[model samples]
Target: MSDSQLISDFFSRDVLLGDRALKAAVADRGEEALRLFIPEQEGYGASGLQIEQRLAKLAASIGANAVDYLIRVIRNGSWQSMLSAAPAFAGLREHKQRATEGLVDVLKQGEIDSQRLAIEALGYLGADDLAFCISEFAENGEWIPQRDHRRQPSRYHLDKFYFYVAQALIRMTASLTSVNAISRCLRQFRDFLPICDEVLGQNRISGWDVRFVQHNFPSRAADPLVRDWIASDSHFLQDCGVEALGHLRLSRTSAFLLSVLEDPRFNDSVRKTAGISLSEFADAGAAAKLAERLNSASDSPGFSWAFASLYAHDVAWPACDEFVEELLGQENNDSEISAHMIYSLACRGDTRAERSFSALNSQHLHMRGTGAIACARFNPESAREALFGRDEEANNPMELACILAAQVHAGHVEKVDSLHQALTTFGELPFLRPIWKREVLYAFFVAEGSDSERGRLWCEAALETPRRVVTEMQALLKRRAREVSANRLPRSQAELASAASRESQEVKDKFDVFISHASEDKINLAEPLYHALVAAGVTVWFDKTELKLGDGLRRKIDEGLARCRYGIVILSPSFLAKQWPQNELGALMARETVSGVKAILPIWHDLSVEELLRQAPMLADRLACRSSEEMSSIVAKILDVLKD
Candidate 1:
């Protein structure tokens, strides 16, 4: 298409039309088409801002040819577009000198909005040479008291122009020489604290902006200000204050932090933050005080136990044994709570709680896992016996995984062969719990420490396993592998063989399969399919079973995609309508481009291939099994695909 036609198409009101137009502009005309589309003045609304953002991204992608265009946008485009284009100018290495000069000129002569954009652009561009000029603007910039034309009226004392200047100075502080100038401006602005406080009081300013102000202040000046903030009525400020105090580690404020922790009226979150700050103190008294709080708040042990754990790690807490024992003896406490108490007691070399370990095996499934882990820690023989005993009878995969983990953690090298056999047998089953797969994998990786061939094989298998394991265990395995690799080198053929085995495992993906489906399809199709795959010994990421509370859904899903060998996207009308499933599919497709793997295994669910093509054409191209088929036949097909 011609540049003007592409530009018109790119700016079309329809989302899809705009996307297609932009693609054509970039693919065919490249930088020339992007330049033609840049808005010349401050008139385009939200849609215009989005288009400019896209243009900025495209301009950055084209490198130097788009630098002049981006500079022009900074000098003439709408305020929002100028802000959007500022970072693009920062990425131009070859034309930075010219871009810098242009931005400086805009700062000096452009309208207020343009000047603000220029200041921020200079910061991002790392124009440290203009730190003095920027500092001058920050200190003496006019505080226009006019209402914001686009948004609600305000009582903000400093205008948008000065706010951007302060923001720029904050960014500039990363350069050593800019620190003094920024600090001076910060002190000067301290005079406007009441106005800033009023702005904060009225909830007009972002907590992030307020934190920026707090973070830039010199510690000597910040100490008292943060101390005052801790006392402020605003819980956000109080939380920030506590966090700042923790980072500063000012010995003098230990008493103040202790006071915050002691205050019953303070929000639990603020108290929790204060407790974290207290944990940083070197004083043994901090541990004692934390213990006192743990004792007082028997009803709410989560934060108190967290603080106590931190304190126990930092200082010698001889008193914690009694606290832990008392807490453990209580029947009302759950297995997790009891486990923490046991762990704390064990940390102090107090094995008096070992008697309670047997009871954990009978508690909730999760508690039983924790108990198994503790058993491995406190008593290895018991852990090994438990694993052997539960190998055949344990129905819950997580519980079995935990027992296996205990066996590995206890260094049961002789049992590795048997464990591997058990794993193989378990994999052939029709329904394995997703958590069990992770736990078993984790145990195998952990137990791979032996120099035996079986140990090497287990390690190799773990290294080959894809992202089916939980993030924590994955990180631990990576760290352990690095430690193992760094500690020694192979000096013989046998050693070389061992090293080669581990090396060979790295080529394989961690997970055998990832089950992707809509939550609505859980009971009818997804659940049955997931169980079938697991029973057949495939590692799968099924959301119904894998996702835990407190996980960021998108982040967890991304991790699953990165680790899985194949994605089973169950295509249904409901699945197509949901944003998350589509997002997951998009991520899987992106991964395919990088990994050169045909990763998706689509399953048709009450939908025809034509219907699927209407929603996801690329996915429709893949061979798929129908949900209407016999469950066992479908499972067999999925197993066959995984086996290959």
Candidate 2:
């Protein structure tokens, strides 16, 4: 058949040989066959979803083998084709050098949508050198507001090219600190702030990007500008300032934030935000001042004092007790404040608050819950008694959850079991509030013991719970598991080094280490460690380093795992929840069992020994290190382990 006939036959649903014909066409005609599906034309006769899926599958099949053809599709095909081809290009790790060159070409020449796809692909491929390329596009790109003739105020839209480019840069820099790529890009686009502000005022930008700036770019040169925004009449600007100040934690701004809090002239939102920001400061004076304000104020200004008290506790200010006492003395009888005071006292292990155990029967259910929690810390028996005596029929889920949490704290395993039975029995009742279900799940999570086999059984049950409950329970379990791991004795230096040597001798591998981590942790903890390992002359097989354009991601990762002498499992909340990392860890464990050699190195990040035990009991006894230690020190220690 002629090429046209072949193309026609391939897209024809009636043709049994369509898949075969298309494969042959792609192999023979390359770009020509791919281009047919590029535009929204009659010849390319598939629904949008069908077209996208078909194109994605075809691109994956061709992969690195047809890098040139894929590049042509990106360069010459219609917008639709470019979008479909971008993922293929990103996945082509074997041909990364060529694929990146092609993507950069498309980035320079393609339309806004095409540019966005290219930018995203490049980011996925870890092309950090192209940071300038992305920043340049963002700087030069125009704002194209969507036009609507029917509407009076036309909705504003940024050139999505610039927006995606900024997004991509943030992703790339998230895991890396040496580059400071995000700050650099922000500086380059500093002149565009007015335009950005205008667009932001119209709510054109996503809340994610705004939060990203407030979180990641704090203490930058632009912070002064952000501070100026606090004084602006615009609520958006004020919100941004409050968020930035909280993250920045600049002690210099404590006085200003306190002023904002004390000034009744300001709106409640801004004043409340200032109160939150003031808590971020480690200054004891700030905490004292806030306590004084709480004491003198006629009415409770929402939960500002509660926030301030919590912050004081977090910083471990010596004056926290004084602040808590001041708050307790206040005539304001807000349940929220009372609960917070009880919680603060509980966290501090202060038995002086035992006098307030009677509040466990308070009319306010939340206060009762808080009181139970406080009682559990100082007197577990009292807490258990208080909880058991409560009228079960009248109690809400929050109250029940608090009671169960207190039971967990008191180590009343039998009571916890009874509560779980009650929750499971009536959990799905139509009349029960959704919050009750969530609280029950949380109670189970907190109550479960790290060392207990029953805890594992409960977690398995929690997994089978409702979607929301399951998600919350899983997170809680993971967090508790990390805590367990953290409290355990870490492996000794000599032992770690000995294990690394033995694994190296056994595997005879090309790479010294394989980093298995969750994508969510890539920016904050995983990538930095990956880079640090590489810098320390460790032949690390990290995804960002080893995976190139047009390569099969899973296949490459598997190969790295097989060839590497040792594997580093960076355990975090994100890592525990991700299936891929868990799968990789499972494989690593299998290898260790098969070879009868120690191979996996667990690196704890914000987790405990109990939390680790909940997930991997086998690993609980094994020596591990923490991400909280100095990065360089951690690297040096790992290198010691790697060295023969």
Best by TM-score: 2
lDDT of 2 by residue, 363-438 (tens): 7775776667666544555666666655363357556755665665555655666665444333222222222233
- For each candidate, the alpha-carbon lDDT, in order, equals 0.54, 0.54
Q: Candidate 2, which ten residues in sequence have the lowest lDDT sum?
A: 146-155
Superposed Cα deviation of residue 127, candidate 2 (Å): 5.2
Q: Mark the regions of model 1 whose C-alpha exceeds 4 Å error after superposition.
A: 1-70, 76-84, 87-104, 107-116, 122-169, 177-182, 185-193, 197-201, 208-241, 245-272, 278-306, 312-314, 321-644
Per-prediction TM-score, please? 0.35, 0.38
Residue 97 displacement (Å), model 1: 9.4
Tell me the number of clashing residue pairs for each predicted model.
12, 28
User: How much does candidate 1 score in TM-score?
Assistant: 0.35
> How much does candidate 2 score in TM-score?
0.38
C-alpha lDDT (0 to 100) for residue 413 of candidate 2:
52
